[model samples]
Structure formats: C-alpha cells, structure tokens
Target: ASYPYKTTQQSCKARSSKVGAIKGYGNTLRGDEEGMRQALDTYGPLAAAIHTTTDLQFYGGSSSGHGAGIIDIPSCSKQVDHAIAIVGYGTENGKDYW
Candidate 1:
C-alpha cells in the first residue's frame, strides 16, 4: 500500500486557525544593507537568507579548543542558500558580526 501526500487550501486554513492569527510581517529591499540594518534596529529581529561557505559549514563552536570569534570569511560567496535570523549586531575588537 502507498499513501498520497498532499496539501489543500482547506487543510492550510485548518492548521493556521489552530495557531492563531499572524501579528505582522514586513521585508527589506534586497542588497540594501542600510535598510536591513534600520529594520533590524527597529523591529528587533529579522529573518535573513545567506550564502553558506565551507568555513561557516564547519564552524566548531567555542568547545572545539578554539574560542568562538566572529566568522569572517573574506572570500565568502554572494549566492544566498541558507536561512538565518538576525537577532542582533555588535562590534568586537573593531570587527562587526551578526
């Protein structure tokens, strides 16, 4: 036997109803660094998509015998392929990070 996997508008409605209504939603223009920073500063946090690099993929946290520091991939790519949240930003030792 096989089961069919499908989703309908009615099913979406039912599931959404159980979760309650969405409060608000907004977005910043693509490539607009200043706008993204402004939005983050104003709205608290924002969802962000970024290009993942080998350095980022293998980041070994603070317990890896290497203390955690800003992940600075100088040759980082520009193709966005991963989703992340921009909770906050700050400078450390004259370097900035999200």
Candidate 2:
C-alpha cells in the first residue's frame, strides 16, 4: 500500500484483483454491459464502489499498469479489455454490494 508495492510488478497485479471483486463475478456481481459501462464510463458506480470499500482507491487500465491513475484509455495498447475494481490493499477486496 506504500512505496515498495508501487515499484514492483505486484502493484499492477494487486490493482487488477481489487477491481475484479467489485465487478462481482459469476451470479453475484452479475456480468453484463453495465459492469463494462461502470468501468469504461466515469466513476459513477464502479468508482464509487471502490471508494466506499477502500479509503485509498484508484481506477485505471492495466495496459499501462497504472490502474486507478489511468483515466484515459491508452491508445497504444488494446490488450487491457479486462475491467477490475480494487476493494482494498494487501488483501483482496470482497464484494459487499451487487
């Protein structure tokens, strides 16, 4: 959650998992266009969910490996189609709401 994690590759991996929980998988979160919309669009639901769950929250694309900080979708990489939500730090942030 501090300096060390930021520089390491774990930063990106950690951030990725954070969002994944919030997105709600299987029948719990219910995957749909809305989930994608909440991610792609501004911080309407997706962002709020992250903030409410974690005090130190951020949203961004993994393509740049700058998760929460990356608001603008990087044009250079199209491989970051996967959306995720960072519930907490160190440990995975589980889903609280649907």
Candidate 3:
C-alpha cells in the first residue's frame, strides 16, 4: 500500500489538529492533554518528519480499535505509520527528538 494514505497537504495538516482523532475510543483522551503532551515531549522529535506531499501522506492509515470513525490514534506498535507534529522536545532510547 502507498504511504500517507491521506490525499493532500491540506489534509495532512488537518490530521494533526485531531487529538485522539486516532484514539481507540471515540473522542477518548478528552482530558488526557497532559498525557499527549508528555508523549510529544519525549517522542516528538523521534516522531517522523514530513518534507513532501509524499512525506505528509506517508503515515496515513486506519488503525485497529480506531472505532467506527477516523479519530483513533495510530498504533504505538507500528513504527512510522502515523504522522504527528513535534511541538516539544526530549530524549529517549538515546535519540534526540525535538
């Protein structure tokens, strides 16, 4: 399958605004902003980088337990499968992510 299943740069940017737009439960993580924040902090830089239309669409796909809609988080088990913006920074596995 082609990477970044999403169709365009506009759509790619749109996906980031949705928190848990990829969670397993519908609208779940409603109050877990901090948890997501912590995740971004430590793993943001490690998160994949988008440098092209292809890059933007690179991690697009429907994850399991994503519910009946498209608001479920990507699989933590799947590396480089979903696109997330790195708004924060930190280190993990000795990797410098920003």
Candidate 2 residue lDDT tens string, 1-98: 35333433453433433434444533225335455455544443342222122222343234554463314222343234335553432222542233
TM-scores of the candidates in the order shown: 0.63, 0.20, 0.22
Q: Which ten residues in a row have the lowest lDDT in candidate 3?
A: 65-74
Clashing pairs in 3: 4-57, 4-58, 21-71, 21-72, 22-71, 22-72, 22-73, 23-72, 23-73, 45-98
What is candidate 1's CA lDDT for residue 84? 84
Error of 3 at 67 (Å): 18
Which stretches in model 3 have alpha-carbon errors above 4 Å?
A: 1-50, 53-56, 60-86
Number of clashing pairs, model 1?
0
Please rank every candidate by lDDT, starting with the best.
Answer: 1, 3, 2
lDDT of each: 0.71, 0.37, 0.41
Model 1 lDDT tens row, 1-98? 14322322334323223655558989888867788888988877898888877675546545752336788877646688988889888889999777
TM-score order, best first, reads 1, 3, 2
C-alpha lDDT (0 to 100) for residue 39 of candidate 2: 52
Tell me the tens digit of each residue's lDDT in model 3 across 1-98.
33434344553333335454432322215335566566655544323423233423334333542232222233333234456554664565665434
Which TM-score value belongs to model 1?
0.63
Worst 10 residues of 1 by lDDT: 1-10
